[model samples]
Target chain A: DQQVKQNSPSLSVQEGRISILNCDYTNSMFDYFLWYKKYPAEGPTFLISISSIKDKNEDGRFTVFLNKSAKHLSLHIVPSQPGDSAVYFCAASNRANAGKSTFGDGTTLTVKP
Target chain B: DVKVTQSSRYLVKRTGEKVFLECVQDMDHENMFWYRQDPGLGLRLIYFSYDVKMKEKGDIPEGYSVSREKKERFSLILESASTNQTSMYLCASSSLGRVWGETQYFGPGTRLLVL
Candidate 1:
């Protein structure tokens, strides 16, 4: 069973537009949610995260919103640049689980110039 | 910044050959993990260690074993490599006793192919 799911395998957006990637989770025990960005031939890097206590967290160009009732989370990048193109993964972990993260299938985002 | 390094960026091995993939982390992290990434399956954890000389099996650990003799190093061993094991292997480290959510730092990844 896939606890975390990224239904969309890929997404395309125009430069300077908003790019939104969605993710859903089936486990309600997950308390912490995170997003990681990965490029070709490279490892994934931490992008943004949101705790279950808060509904939203924003960092510069990246923002993550969490809806606990719906068990869904979304990552939004405003004014998307070509360099923002990469595979994005959504992961969740509960404090009781000792931070062992369960990651999604990942969504490949392409920002067109 | 946490830096995780893998021994090789690419490797090739034959079936039934023993393979070892080494990983080292600069940060004094207490937790280390090994994961395999496939084309459509995403990243699946093979094994993880919470402390030196201590380890646990992840979701998929059938063909893999792990060793952690030192705090900064973790190794994944394939007793007999097979063609189906060909994929990208990723190593990650995370410090324990942090906040509610701890972020893991990953290595560049080692692409392994078995003939």
Candidate 2:
């Protein structure tokens, strides 16, 4: 059973526009959510994260919104650039789990230049 | 910068052959993990070790085994390689900071193709 799920396999957006990637989870025990961006032939890097206590977290052009009631979270990149085109994976974990995160299938975002 | 290095970027093996994938981390991290990334299946944890001579099975640990004789190195071994085992393998490490849920730093990945 996949605890974390990304319904959309891919997304396309124009440069300078906003790119939104959505993710859902079935486990309510997860209190921490993180996003990772991966490029071809490279490893994934941390993007943004949000805690269950907060509804939103923002850093630069990246913003992550979490809704505990819905067990859903979304990553938003405003003014998306070509460099933002990559696979985004959503992961969830709880403090007691020793950082063993349950990752989603990942969404491939394409930013049109 | 933390650096996680895998033995090979790519490898090919035949059925029934034994395969070993090695990973080394420069940062003195206490936590090391082995994950497999398939097309539709994001990243699945195969094994993880929190310290030298310690190990734990992740979600999918079948058909594979791991060793961490040293704190800096972790190895994933396939006793009898199968075609179904062909996939991208990733290694990650994180320091058990003052907190336990530290972020993980990943390697470039090793793409293994089992024939």
Candidate 3:
């Protein structure tokens, strides 16, 4: 069973516009969530993360919002740039399963300049 | 910064051949994992090691085995190369902490093709 799911396979946006990526999970035990960005032929790099206790986390131009009641989380990029184009993966893990994370299928984001 | 390194960036092997993919971490992490990425399937864990000489099977460990000989190195072994086993393999390591979920550092990944 796929615990974490990214329903959208791909997304296209114009530069300077807002880009939003969504993810949902079925496992309620998951207390921590993470986001990773990957480029072609490269491994995924950590983007931002949120705890179950928090509703939002922001870093620079990126923001992550978590709604525990809905079991959904989203990543938002303000003023999206072409360089931000990449595949984004959403992962969930809890303290009991530290180090082992359940990852979504990933959503490919393309930003047009 | 944590650094994870894999032995190969790409590999090709014929059916029935034995293969080994090596990984090393510089941060002395206690937890290490091996995962395979496939199209539309996301990343599936093959094995995980929490300490030297210790390992646990992951979601898809049917054709794979793992070795953790030291604190810094974790290896993935393919007993018999098969076409279905070809995929991008990733290695990651994370330190233990009081926090709920520690961030994992990943290697560049090794793409293996079996014929």
Candidate 4:
């Protein structure tokens, strides 16, 4: 069973615009959510994360919003740039299970320059 | 900066062959993981080790085994390779001290092809 799911396989947005990537999860036990950005032929790098307590967390150009009621979270990039184009993966895990994470099928973001 | 290095970028092996994939980390992390990435299927964990001489099976550990004789190195062993095992393999390491669910750092993946 897929605990984490990303419905959209790909997304396209214009540069200097906002890019939103959505993800959903079936497991309510997951209290922490993280996003990773991956480039072609390269490993995924950590982007941003949010805890269940907070509804939103922001880091520079990236912002992540979490809704516990909906069991959904989204990663938003403001003024998206060409460098923002990459595959974004949403992962969920709880404190008890520290290193084991359930990752969603990544969403490929394309920022048109 | 933490660095995770895989043994190879690409490899081709014949069926029924024993395949070994090595991974090393320079950060002295206590947690190491091995995952396989297929097209459409995201990263699926095959095995993980929290410390030297300790290991745990992940979501998909069938037809595969792992070893961690040393803290800095982890190895994935395929007893008998099959065509279905052809995929991109990734290695990741994370520190136990982090707060947000152990932020994992990954290395460049190794693409293995079983013919």
Candidate 5:
């Protein structure tokens, strides 16, 4: 079973606009959510993260909003740049569980110039 | 900066051959993990070790084994590689945490091709 899911396989947005990537989870036990950005042939780098207690977390141009009630979360990049184009993965983990994270299928975001 | 290095960026092996993938972390992390990424399937954990000599099976550990003889290195072993095992393998390491979940740093990944 896929505990975490990224319904959208890919997304496209024009440069200088906003890009939003969505993710959902079935497991309520997950209290921590993290987002990672990956480029071709490179490992994923940490972007932003939010705890279950918080509704949103921001890091520079990247912002992650979490809605526990809806069991959903979204990553927003304002003024998206062409360099932002890459695969984004959403992951969640329950503190009680030895920090084993469940990952979504990932969404490929393309920021057009 | 914390760096996770995988032994190889690409590898090719014949079916039924024994294969080994090595990972080394310079961050002095106590936790190390191995995962395989396949198209459409996402990243599935193969194995993890929280401490030297201690290992745990993750979501998918079949046909795989892990060894952590040193704190900074973790090795994944494939007894007999199969074609289905061809995929990108990633290694990650994180520090042990209490209430907060630490972020895992990953290597560039090793693409394994078993023909």
Candidate 6:
């Protein structure tokens, strides 16, 4: 059973437009959510995170929003650049349990010029 | 900066052969993890170690074993390699945290192919 799911396998957006990636989770115990960006042949880099206590968290050009009632979260990147093209993964964790994190299947985002 | 290194970036092995994948971390972290990445499956945990000589199975641990003799190093062993085991392996290390969540630092990854 996949605890976390990214319904869309791929997403495409024009440069300078907003790119939105969505994720859902079935585990209610998860309290912390994070987003990671990965390039080809490179390790994933931490992007932004949101705690269950808050509905939203923002970093520079990236923003993450969480809806606990819906068991869903989304990552939004405004003014998307070509460099933003990569696979994005949504991860969730319940720190109380050994800090193990569950990750989604990842969404490949392509920012077109 | 935290650095996690894998023994090999790519490896090819024949089916039924024993394979060992080694990972080392320089950050003195207490938590270490092993994950396998597939094309559309994302990252799935195989094993994780909380301390020296301690380990716990993750989401997918079948046909895989792990050893953590030292706090800085973790090893994943495939007793008998199979074609289904071909995937990108990743190692990560992180420090335990109380409130401010722990951040996992990952290695580049090792691509393994079993023919």
Off by over 4 Å in 3: none
Residue pair clashes in candidate 2 = none
Please provide, for model 2 over A1-113, each residue's C-alpha lDDT reduced to its tens digit, 9 standing for 90 to 100.
88999999999999999999999999999988999999988888888888888999999999999999999999999989999999999999877776678889999999999
- Judge the docking of candidate 1 as incorrect, acceptable, medium or high: high
DockQ of each: 0.82, 0.63, 0.76, 0.77, 0.76, 0.71
Per model, the share of native interface contacts recovered reads 0.69, 0.52, 0.62, 0.71, 0.56, 0.50
Once fitted onto the true fold, the runs of candidate 5 whose alpha carbons sit more than 4 angstroms away are none
Candidate 3 residue lDDT tens string, A3-109: 99999999999999999999999999999999999998888899999999999999999999999999999999998999999999999998897568889999999
The window of 10 residues in a row where model 5 chain B has the poorest summed lDDT is B94-103
Estimate, for each residue in A12-51, the C-alpha lDDT of model 6 and write its tens digit.
Answer: 9999999999999999999999998999888888899989
Write model 4 residue lDDT over B69-98, tens digit each, in one string. 999999999999999999999999998887
Q: Which stretches of candidate 6 lie over 4 Å from their true place?
A: B98-100
Interface Cα RMSD for all candidates? 0.8, 1.7, 1.0, 1.1, 0.9, 1.1
CAPRI quality level assigned to candidate 5 from its DockQ score = medium
Instruction: Please report, in order, the local distance difference test score of every candidate based on alpha carbons.
Output: 0.95, 0.92, 0.93, 0.94, 0.93, 0.94
In candidate 5, what are the lDDT values of residues B1-115, reduced to their tens digit?
9999999999999999999999999989988999998888888999999999999999999999999999999999999999999999999998875576768899999999999
User: Model 2 lDDT vs. the true structure?
Assistant: 0.92
lDDT of 1 by residue, B1-115 (tens): 7899999999999999999999999999999999999987778999999999999999999999999999999999999999999999999999888778789999999999999
Cα lDDT over the full model 6: 0.94
**Higher-ranked by TM-score: 2 or 5:** 5
**DockQ score for model 1:** 0.82
**RMSD in Å for model 2:** 1.1
Instruction: Pick the winner on lDDT between candidates 2 and 6.
Output: 6
- Which is superior by TM-score, 3 or 4? 3
**Comparing to the true complex, what docking class would candidate 2 get?**
medium
